[model samples]
Structure formats: C-alpha cells, structure tokens
Target: MTHRQVMEALSGLLLGLFVAVLSSTVVSNALPHILTDLHGGQSAYTWVITATLLTLTASTPIWGKLSDLASKKLLLQIALAIYIASSALAGLSQNTGELIACRALQGIGAGGVTALAQICLAAMVPPRERGRYSGYFGAVFALATIGGPLIGGVIVDTSWLGWRWCFYVGIPFALAAILVVQRTLKLPVVRRTVRIDYLGALAITGAVSLLMIWITLAGKNYAWLSWQTAAMVGGGLLLGALAVVIERRAAEPIIPPDLFRYRTVALAALASVLVGVGMYGATTFLSQYFQLARAKSPTMAGLMTLPMILGLALASTVAGRLITRYGKWKAYLVCGTLLLAIGFGLLGTARADTDYGLLSVYMAITGIGLGLTMQNLVLAVQNTVPRNELGAASSVVTFFRTMGGAMGVSALGALMTNKVGHYLAENLAAAHIPAGRAVAGGGIPDLHKLPAQVVPLVTDAFGHGVGMVFLCAAPFALLAFVTVLFIRETALKTDQQG
Candidate 1:
C-alpha cells in the first residue's frame, strides 16, 4: 500500500481508536457527579471503572484471535455497533448497578475495537514503517484522553446536557468511523479452518474474573487473608492453571502457548503489565484528586491535566518519526520508563496545597514517558512476530497491559478508600466535629454541600491518601524500566509480510 492508501485506511481506524479511547476517558471527570447522583460510595466508583477494564481485559485476546480468523473490517463495524448501542443504554442507567452492567457490555465492544484497530494496522503496514503509524494511534489516544475529561467536565457542568451526555457524545463519532471504515478500509482475508476455543476462553475469562473480584473486594468487604480471599485466590489459580493446560492442548488456543517462547514477547508482555499498573493505577484517580482535594471545578480539573496530554502527544509524534527514520526504538522505551518512575516518585510527595505548576511538571514527565513506552511495546512484539501471529501477539501484550490496569485500579482504589476513611476520621475528631451526613454516608462528598469547616479536612484526607497511591505506583514503573532494558533489540522488518 502507498502512503496515501495507508493514511486513507487509517482515517477510519484512527477514528475507531479515538472512539474506543474516548469512551473510557470522557467519564473520568464526570465520575464524581455520576456517583453522587446515583447515591454510590467509593467502592461503586472503583467498580464502575473496573467493570469496563475487567471485561476489556478478558475479551481482548478472544477478539484478537477472531481478527486472525475473520473479516477485520466487518468485526470492527460489529464492535462499533455494540459500543454505540451499549453507550446509549449506559446514558439511561438509573443506578450505579445498571451503569456498571452497561459499561461491561461496552467493554466487550471496546476489546474488539482496540485489538482489531492495531491488528488491521499490522495487516496494512510493514513492521519498520509501523512506528510512524503507531505514533498516530498514540496521538489519537492522547487526544481522547485529554478530550474525554474536558468534554465530560463541560457536560457535567452544563445543567441541560448533564453527565448523561458524556455517554452519548461519542455515538456520532463512532457512527462516522463505521461509515469511513466501510468506505476506505480493505484487507485480504486468509481462508482457514476456524475452530473457536471455547474451553480456553471460558477458563481464562473465569480466571481473570475471579482474581479481579478478589482484588476489588479483598480489603474493604473482608480481610485480605480471610476465607473469602482464600477461596477466590485458590479458585482463580486453579482456573489459570486450567487455562494454561487447555491452551497447550487445544487445536486453537485463544492465547498461543508457544508465543511465550520468544523472549521479546514474554518481556514485552511483562513490561506492558507494569506500565499499565503504574500508568492506569495512579492516573485513574487524578480527576478525583483535583476535584476533591484541590477543590477545582471539573472543567478546571480537565484543563489542569492538559500539560500531561500535550507532553504525550508531542513525545509520541516525535519519537515515532525518529524511530521510522533511524529504525531504533529501545532508547525511547528506556527513557520513557525512567521518566515514568521519576514522575510517579515526584507526584508521591504532592499535598492538597501543592503548587499547580509543580503538579503540571510532574504530569508532563509521566505523559512523555507513557507516549514513548506504551505503543512501542506493542510495536516491539509485532516486529519480532511472524505476520500470521500478529493478532495474537499484539493482543497478548494488550491483554496483560489491560489486566494490569484492572488490578492496579481495583487494588489502589481500595487502598485509597481505606486511607481516606482513616484520615477523615482522625481529622474530624481533631476538629471536634461529628461525622456529618455527607461524611458519615461514606459516598463521594459534594463539596458545595459540605460545611466550610469540614471541607479542608476532606480535601486534606484525599490529598494524603492519593499521594500514597502514587507512592505505591512508583516502584512498579521502576520495575517496568528494568524489564524493558533486557529486551534484545531486533531490527524491524521492512517486508510488509512480516
């Protein structure tokens, strides 16, 4: 394909990518308002995010395997249709339970859109030339990440539009993507005997679901070492072992067991997991921090996060072009991971009263690191794998990254809840104030409704608790940095068939 053809095809793929990313992000800033309106607590807040990620993680490899066997364009459209329908249903949700259920359905579509977008790109572009295009993916991701919050914030703040618009806003864009895909995207389908690996899929999904349930509920509902934990953890491990066995013996495994034989695939998968943990776990709560801890309006919170998004956009575009020109990528990954660790470490010291200038600087560093690291990890795996295995290999890395994200968000959110609760208690006692209705209910507080005297305590508690979340995340970033260092660099294949 000529550059023009590639760009034309990508026009639709990127739009689909943008919609997938936007769905997850646009809700970030509005989550507080959504929770408050639904009469939900911190647990509900975490589950809303976790439900999407958990389903996305579980379904990614299945979608990837299906891409290898089916029509990429047709699959993409089906995913878009599912996303549009579920997103509309989500907007009509009357309770948090309904919202979470809808979000889970949305994730099933997102898994297809995100996994298939990259798989389709690999089908069109050579490994060596893919860096330039992958950069485009990163840019769209950054745009959606930045835009989602701003859009969500504005929608929430707008009385007529309300938070529901956040779910509805992406439908038109998704619909347009489907039309564009039908018009521009073209790929040759390989004919093969298709065998769906139902047992492997069921076992892996069950395993991930059990573990995620344990992670999300362990500390809050029961002690970590309790009987519920033992049963869930033990059951999850058994299911995971069963998945490995099923994969090894199955005619068509969802995750091919032999792929792990390549050191690049294994290391990239591990590093992606760590990156997801550090990136998603720590950053998911930033909007909450800005709103609850710093008392910024949702719109202002979105604006304040611009530095990070801009940094990501700039770094991805520049690094991608450089990689294409020079055909070297490891240095960028190394620097990005290092920067990620440093950024998380710096943010760990933040307080409610910390200067905005300093926070912006820290966020930018993190964003730059992510831009350099995330897509490149997938690119690295793609460069080394045969063209035939592209979907499974790419999805392997994506699946682990998303799984790490789900785990990080669930575990860290639980920790933040406990820490915030403890601090809120201590501070309230110190101030000789009884736990008011807002405080006692344990739901996310409406700052405007709180007593002026009690506001600072809530903010301070959130500030301290959120800081601890970043502190815990910093080590994972460092581990990712180390993991990337050991991946032996392979020259990207110029052959489009690679």
Candidate 2:
C-alpha cells in the first residue's frame, strides 16, 4: 500500500480508535455527576471504571487471536456494532448496577476494537514506516482526551442533556467509522486453523476477577490480613496458577507462553504493566480532585486538563517523525519513563491549595511521557516479532497494560477511600463536629448540600487523599523507567517480514 492508501484505510481505523478512547475519557468528568445521581458510594464509583477495564483486559487477547484467524475488517465492524448497542443500553441504565453491567458489555467490544486497530495497522505498514503513522494514533488519542471531558461535562451540566448523553454521544461517530471502514479498508484475509483456548480464557478471567474483588474489598469490607482476604487471595493465586498451566498445555493459548522467551517482549510487557498502574491509577481521580477539592465546575475541570493533552499530542507527533528519521527509539522510551516518574512525583505534592499553573505543568510532563512511551512500547515488540506473531505479540503487551490498569484502579481506589474516610473523620473531630452530623453515608457528598462550615473539611480530605494516591503511583512509574532501561533497541525492519 502506498502512503495515501494507508492513510485512507487509517482514516476509518483512527475514527474507531477515537470512539473507543472517547468512551473512556468522556466519562471521567461526568463520573462524579453520574455517581451523585445514582446515589452511589466510592466503591460503586471504582467498580464502574473497573468493570470496563476488567473485561477489556480479559477479552483483548481473545480478539487478537481471532484477528489472526479471521478477516480483520469484519472483526472491526462487529466490534463497533457491539459498542454502539451496548452504549445505547448503558444510556438507559437506571442504577449503578445496570450501568456497570452495560459498561462490561461495552468492554468486550472495546477490547476487539483496541486490539484489531493495531493488528490492522501492522498489516498495512512495515515497522520502519509505522512510527510516522503511530503518531496519528497519538493525535487521535489527544483529540479524544481533549474532547471527551469537555463534551461529557457539557452534556452533564446541561439541564436537558444529562449524563446519559455521554453514552449516546459516541454512537454517530462509531457508525460513521464502520461505514468508512467498509468502503476503504482492503486487506487479504489470512486463514488458519481456529482453535480458541476457552479454558485458558475462563481461568484468566476468573483469576483476574477474584484478584480485583480482593483488591477493591480488602481493607474496606474486611481487614487485609483477615480470613476473607486469605481465602480470596489464595483462591486468586490458585486460579492464576491454573491459568498458566492451562495456557502451557492448550493447543492455542490466548497468550502464547513462548512469547515471553524473547527478552524484548517480556520487558515490554512488564513495563506496560507498570505504566498502566501509574497512569490509570493516579489520573483516574483527577476529575474528582478538581471538582471536589478545588470546587471547579465540570467544564472548567475539562479545560484545566488541556495542557496535558496538548503536550501528549506534540510529543507523540515529533517523536514519531524523529524515530522514523533516525531509527533510534530507546532514548525516547528512557526519557519518557523518567519524565513519567518525575511528573507523578511532582503531582504527589498537590493539595486543594496547589496552584493551577503548577498542576498544569505536572500534567503536561505526564502527558508527554505517556505519548512517547505507550504506542512505542508496542512498536518495539512488533519490530522484534515475526509477521505472523504480530497480533499475539501486540495484544500481549496491551493485555498486560490493561490488566495493570484494572488492578491499579481497584487498589488505588481502595487506598483513596480509606485515606479520605480517615481524613474526613479526623477533620470533623478537629472541627468539633459530631461524626453523625457529617455526611452520613459513603456516597459522594454534594458540597452545595453540606453546611458552609463542613465544605472545607471534605475538600481537604479529598485533596490530601488524592495527593497520596499520586505519591504512591510515582514508585510504579520509577520502576517502569528501570525496567525499560534494559530493553535493547533493534533497528526497525523496513520490510514487512525482515
């Protein structure tokens, strides 16, 4: 395919990518409103996000494997159809439980879309030229990141539109992407004997679900060292071990055990996990911080995050061109991870009183780091693997990244819950306010409804608790830096099967 033909096919793929990314980012600012409207607590809030990530993580490898055996274009369309239907259903959800279930369904589709997008892209472009195209991915991500919050905020804040519109808003874009893909995407279908490892998939899902439940519920519902913890943790480990065993013996494993033998693949997968942990875990709570602690409107909260998005857009585009021009990637990866750690560290010091200028600077540093790191990790793995293994190898990295994200959100959310509760209690006592007089439930409190004297305490608790969340995330980013440092760079193959 010529560059023009590649871009033409990519136009639809990028749109699909935009819809997938938009689904997640658009909900960030609206989540506070969504929870408040549903009368949900912190646990429910975490579950809302976790449900999607959990399913997306588990299903990604399945989709990737299927891509190897089927028509990529057809799979992409099916995924988009699933997304459109589930999203519409989600808009009709009357409660958090219903919403979470719908979101889980959405994840199945998102998993396919995410994995297939990269698979299709790799099929079209060789690794040497892929960098320049990957930059477009970063641009699409930036647009979605920049737009989702603002769009969601507006929809939620509008008296008539409501938070449900956030779910419905992406349907038109998704529909258009499907049409464009049908018209422009032309790829030769590769036929292979299809043998999905259902048992391996089930075991992986069960193990991840058990661990996620344990992470979310450990300190809140039971002591971390209690019998319940022991049972869940032990059970999760057993399931995980079972998954590994099943994968090793299966005719076609969802995640190929042999892929890990390659040092680049292994290190890249590990680094992706750490990056996901730090990035998803810490950034997930920023909307709450801006709204609950800083007392900003959802619209303003969206605007406040622009610096980060812009930084990401700029870094990804420039880095991609440079990598293609010079064929060196490790230096950018190393610098990007270093910047990630520094960004998280700086954000750790944030409180309700932190200046916007300073916060923007921190966010920009983080965004630039992400742009340089995320897609490049997959590019590194792709460059090393054979053409036939592209789908599996690429999805493996994404699978780990998303698995890390799910765990990060659950664990960090639990930590934030505990810290916030403690601070709220302490602040109430310090203010001579009775505990009973404070917000009575774990449901997110509306500052407008609180007594004037109590608002500052709630804000302070959230500010301090959220800061601690970012502080905890910094170590993970630092670890990612250390992990990627050992990845030996190889020149990208100019040929499809070099």
Candidate 3:
C-alpha cells in the first residue's frame, strides 16, 4: 500500500479504534449513577468494569491469532458488528448483572479492535514510517480518552439523556466505521488452515477469572489469609501453569512462548504491566474522588480532568513525531517513567481540601507519562519482531497490560473499601454516630442523602483512601522505569518484514 492508500485505510481504521476506546471509557462518569440505579455496592461497581477488562484481556490473544490466519478486514467488520449489538443491548439492561454480562460481550469485540488495529496498520506501514502515522493513532486515542468522559458526563447529568445514552451513543459511530472500512481498507488476504489453541485459551481464561475473583473478594467475603484465599490462589496458579503447558504443545499457540525469548519483548512486556498498573489503578477512582469526595457534579468532574487529557494529547503526538524524526525512543521511555513516578508521588498527597491547581498538575504529569509510554511500548515490540509474528507479539504486550489494569482496579478497589470502612468506623465512633447511619452504605455513596455531620466524615475518608491508592501505585511506576532501562534499543525498520 502506498502512503495515500494507507492513510485512506487508516481514516476508517482510526474511527473504528476511536469507537472501541470510547465505549471502554465512556462509562467512567456514568458508573456511579448506573450502579446506584441498579442497587449495586462497591464490589458490584468494580466487577462491572473488571468484567469488560477481563474478557478483553483473555480474548485479545485469540483475536490476534485469528488475525494471522483469517481475513483481517472480515474479522474487523465482525468485531465491529459485535460491538454495535452489545452496546445497544447494554443500554437496555435493567440491572447490574445484565449490564456486566453485556459489557463482557462488548469486550469480545474490543479485544479484536485493540489487537487488530495495530496488526492491520503494521501490514500497511513499515516500522520506520509507522512512527509518523503512529502520531495519528495517539491523537485518536487522546481524542477518545478526552471525549469519552465529557460525553459520558453530559449524558449522565442530562435528565432526559440519562446514563443509558452513554451506551447507545457509540453504536452509530461503530456502524460508520464498518462502512468506511468496507469501502476504504484494501489488504491482501493470506489464506491458511488455522489451528487455534482452544485449551490454552480456556486455561488462560480460567486463570484470569480466578485471580480477579480472588482479588475482588479476598478482604470482603473472606480473610486474605484464610482457606478460601488459599484455594483461589492455588487454583489460579495451577490454571496458569496448565496454560503454559498447553501453549508449548499446541500446533499453533495463541501466544507464542518463543517470542519472550527476545530480551526486548520480555522487558517491554514487563514494563507494559507496570505501566498499566500505575495508569489504571491511579486514574480509575479519580472521577469518584471528584464527585464523591470533592462534591463536584459529573460534568464538573469531567471538566476538571481536562488538564490531564491535554497533557496526554500533547505528549503522545509530540513523542511519536520526534521518535520518527530521530529514530531514538529510549530517552522518551526513561523520561516518561520518571515523570510517571513523580506524578503518582505527588498525587499521593491528595486530601478533601487538596488544591485544584496542584491536583491538575499531578494529573497532567501522569498523563504526559502515559502518552509517551502506552503506544510507544507496542511500537518498540513491533520494531523487533517479525511481521508474521506481529499479531502474537503485539497481543502479548497488550494482554499483560490489560491484565495489569484488571488486577490493579480489583486490588485497589478492595483496598479502598477496607480503608474507607475502617476510617468511617473510626470517625463515626468519635462523633457518637451509629453504625447504621445512611452514609455507611458500601456502594457509590449518595452524599446528598447523608446527614450533614456524616457527609464531611465520609468524604474525608474517601479522599484519604484515594491518596493511599496513588501512593500504592507509585512504586509500580518506579518499577516500570527500572525495566525500561534494561530494554536494548533497536533501530526502527524502514521496510515491511512480512
């Protein structure tokens, strides 16, 4: 494909990518409202998000494996179609369970979009020229990231539009992407007899599900050190061990184990996990922080996050262009990780009375680090591996990152719940308030319904918990920095290797 043809195809592809990313995040501001309406508690709230992420993580390798054997364009369309159907159905869900089920279905399509977008793009552009085009990819991601929250907030806050519209809003955009791709994307199909590793896929899925369940329920449903915890941890590890064995023996492995033999791929995968942990864990509760702790409206919460989005947009686009121009990426990775650590370190000081100006700066710093790190990590892996292995290699990095995000959210959420419970109990006892106070509800706290004296204490507890979450995230960022230091820099390839 020529430059003009690639860009034309990418036009449709970026839109498709945008829709996938938008659907994933558009619920951030609306989640509180959704859970409240469905009568869900804190665990339910975390699972709603975790369910989607878990499916996306588990299915990514399967989608990537199929991309190598099937028609890329056909697979892309099928994924989009699934997304459209699931999103529409999710809007009609009457309860949290239904919504979580729909979200899991939605994740099946998302897994394809997230992996195949890069795979399709790599087929069209060489690693060298990919940097120039990658800037556009970064821009699209930034746009989706920025737009999702704002749109979700607006829909959530609007009485008539409501949170349901957040699900419905992306359907048209997804449909449009399908049409555009059908017309514009022209890739040569490589037909081959595909042998999918079903056992490996199932094993990995079981492992991930068990691990996530353990993380979500450990401190709440059972003691972290109890027999239930031991059983879950043992089961998850046993399943993970089974997955490795299956992958090694499979005719065509879902995730090719040999790819990890490459030092750069191994290091990059590690870095991706750490980065995902810090990024997702720290940012997941920020909206709640703004709305619940600071008592801001949904729209106001989204608007307040603008500085972070702006920094992300600017850094990703700029970093991509510069990397393309200079053909050097190590500095950006190192600097970005350092900035990420510092960002989380500063954010750890957050309190109910934290200054907006200072918080914005911390968020922007973290955003800039993410913008530099997220896309570039995949690009680095793509540069080192063979094109035929692109699907597996790319998905491996993405798979771990998504797993990290799922784990981070579950762990941090459980931590916050315990911390909040402890803090609330302490404050209530000091104030001579009973344990049955309205503010003691475990789910999304409705501040307006609480007694005047209880509201401040509840908000302060949340603020303190959020601060601890960020503090816990800081060490992960530093670990990412250390891992990036060991990744050997390889020059970007100028010719397509496939």
Candidate 4:
C-alpha cells in the first residue's frame, strides 16, 4: 500500500480507537452524578468501573485470536457496531445494575477495537515506519482521554443533556468509524481451518472474574484471611493454572504462551502490567478527588485534568518522531518509567487543600511518562515477534496491561472506600453525630446534601483516601522502572518482514 493508502486506512482505525478510548474515560467526571442518581454507594461506583475493565481484559485475547483467523475489516466493523449499540443501550439504563451490564457488553466491543487496531497497523506499517504512525495513535488516545471527561462533564452539567449523553455521544463516532473502514480499509483475509479454544477462554474468564470478586469484596463482605477469601483466591489460581494447561494443549490458544520466551516480550509484558497498575489505578479517581474533596464542578474537574493531557500529547508526538528518526527507544522507556514513579509520589501528597499549580505539575509528569512508555512497550515486543504472531503479541501486552488495570482499580478502590469510611466514622464520632446515619442516608458523597458542619470532614476523608491510593500505586510505578532497566535493547528493524 502507498503511504496515502495507509494513512487513509488509518483514519477509520484511529477513529474507532478514539471511540473505544472515549467510552472508557467519558464516565469519570459524570460518575459522581450517575451514582447519586442511581442511589449507589462507593462499592457501586467501583463496580461500574470494574465491570467494563474486567470484560475488556477477558475478551481481548479472543478478539486478537479471531483477527488472525478471520477478516480483520469485518471484525473491526462488527466491533464498532457492538460499541454503537451498547453505548445506546447504556444510555437507556434505568439503574446501576443495568448500566453495569451494558458497560460490560460495551467492553467486549472495546476489546476488539483495542486489539484489532494495532493488528491492522502492524499489517500495514513495518516496524521502522510504525513509530511515526504510533504517534498518531497516541495522539488519538490523548485526545480522547482529554475530551472524554470534558464532554461528559458538559453533558452532565447541562440540564437538557445530563449524564446519559456521555454514553450516547460516542455512537456517532463509532458509526462513522464503521463506514470509513468499510469503504477504505483493506487487508488480506487469510482463509484457513480455525479452532478456537473455548474451554481455555472460559477458564481464563472465570479466573479473572473470581479474582476481581475477591479483590472488590474481600474487606467489605468477608474477612481478608477468611475461608471465603481462601476459596475465591484459591479457585482463581486453580483456574488460571488450568488455563495455562489448556492453552498448552489447544491447537490454537487464545494467548500463545510461547510469545513470552522472547526476553523483550517478557520484559515488555511485565512493564505493561506495572504501568497499567500505576497509571490506570491512580488516575481513575482523580475526578472523584476534585469533585468530593476540592468541591469542583464536574466541568472544572475536567478542565483541571488538562495539564496531564497536554503533557501526554506533547510527549507522545515528540517521542514518536524522535524514535522514528533515531531508531532508539529504551532511553525514553527508562525515563518515562522513572518519571511515572516520581509523578505518583508527588501526587500521593495531595490533600483537600493541595495547590492546583503543584498538582498540575505532578499530573503532567505522570502523563508524559505514560505517553513515553505505553505504546513503545508494544513496539518493542512487536519488533521482536514475527508478523504472523503480531495479533497475539499485541493483544498479550494489552491484555496484561488491562488485567493489571482491572486488578489495580478493584484493589485500590476498595482501599479508598475503607479509608474514607474510616475517617468519616472517626470524625462523625468526635462530633457526636451518628456515623451510621450519615453514611446510610448518604449516596455517592454529595457535599451539597450534607450539613455544612459535616462537609469538611467528608471532604477530608476523600482527600486523604485519594492521596493514599496514589501512594499505594507509587511503588508499582517504581517497579516498572526497575523492570524496564533489565530489558535488553533491540535495534529497530528497517526492513519489513512477514
């Protein structure tokens, strides 16, 4: 394909990617309102996020495996359709339970978009040229990341539109993506006898579900060291082991285990996990911090996040072009990971009264680090793996990162909830107010509904909880840096190989 043709095809793919990413983030600012409207608590707020991440993590490999055997273009179209439909359905959800179900369905589509977009890019662009194009992907991601919250905030604050538009807003973009791909994107649809490892897929899904259940519910519903915890944890591990055994024996595994044999792939996978845990885990609650602790309007909360988005966009665009020119990437990876640790460390100190200027600097640092690390990790692995394994390799890294995100969000969310509740109880007790009454009647921590005297305590509880969440995530970011240090540098390939 000519350069023009590749760019043309990428238009649809990038739009699809933007839509997928947009869905993931658009709910962040509006979440406070959504949960309030639905009469949900902290646990419900976490579940709303977990449901989507869990499905996205579990279904990613299936989409990647299917990409290798089926028509990439058809799969992309199907995925977009799924997203469009699910988004519309999500907007119509009457309660938190319905919304969570729709979000999980939406994630199945997102998994496809995430896996297939990279696979198509790998098919069209060789490693040497991919960095430049990967920059565009990064740009779309940053754009979506920035725009999602802002748009959702606007919709939520608007009387006529409300938060439902956060879900509905992505439909048009998804449809446009489908039409563009149908018209422009083309790839060889290799026909072969296909064998899907359904059993392995089931085991993997069950294992992930079990683990997330444990992570989200351990301290709340059951003791951390009790029989329930042991049962769930033990069951998840057993199923995961069974998945490995099944994958080894299957004719076509969802995740090809041998991909990990390459040192670069192994290191990249580890880095992806660490990056995901720190990045996704800590960032998920930023809006909550702003809304609950700082008492910012959703729109203001969205705007406050702009520094980080700007940093991400700038770093991704500049780093991509530089990597293309220099054929060197490890320095950026190392620098990015180090900065990520530092950023989290700084953000961990934030409290209800944190200066916006200082917080912006910390957020920008984390964003730059993410821009530098996220795509390049995949590039490093892609450079080492053969073209036939591109889909699987790309999906593997994405799968782990998402799985890490799922785990991080679940675990950290639980911690945040407990901390907030603890602080609230203590403060309420000191004030001679019944903590249970305040908590039981309160839904989703709206400061406006609380007595003026109690507002300060609630905000402090949230602020401290948010800070602790980031503090917990900082070590993971540091570990990512450590993992990247051990990765052996592999020169970028100049020639296309298939």
Tens digits of lDDT, candidate 2, 253-316: 9999999999999999999999999778745788889888888888888989888789889989
Q: For residues 287-308, what per-residue lDDT tens digits would candidate 3 score against the true structure?
A: 8788888988878888888877
Q: What is the TM-score of each candidate against the true structure?
A: 0.99, 0.99, 0.98, 0.98
Tens digits of lDDT, candidate 4, 1-498: 888999999999999999999998899999999998988888888888889889999989999899888899999899889999899999999999999999999999999998899989988888888899999999999999899989989999999998999999999999999999998998988866878999999999999999998999999899899999999999999999999999999989999889888999998898888898887775589989999999998889989999888888889889999999999999999999999999999999999999999999999999999999998998998899988888889999999899989889999999998898888888888888877546574357778888888888889888988999999999998999999999998889876684
Kindly indicate the candidate among 2 and 3 with the higher TM-score.
Answer: 2
lDDT of 1 by residue, 95-115 (tens): 999999999999988988999
Off by over 4 Å in 4: none
Clashing pairs in 2: none
Q: Model 4 residue 63 lDDT?
A: 90
Mark the 10 consecutive residues where model 1 has the least summed lDDT.
433-442
| Candidate 1: stretches off by over 4 Å | none
lDDT of each: 0.92, 0.91, 0.88, 0.90
Candidate 1 local distance difference test against the native: 0.92
Alpha-carbon deviation at 332 in model 1, angstroms? 1.1
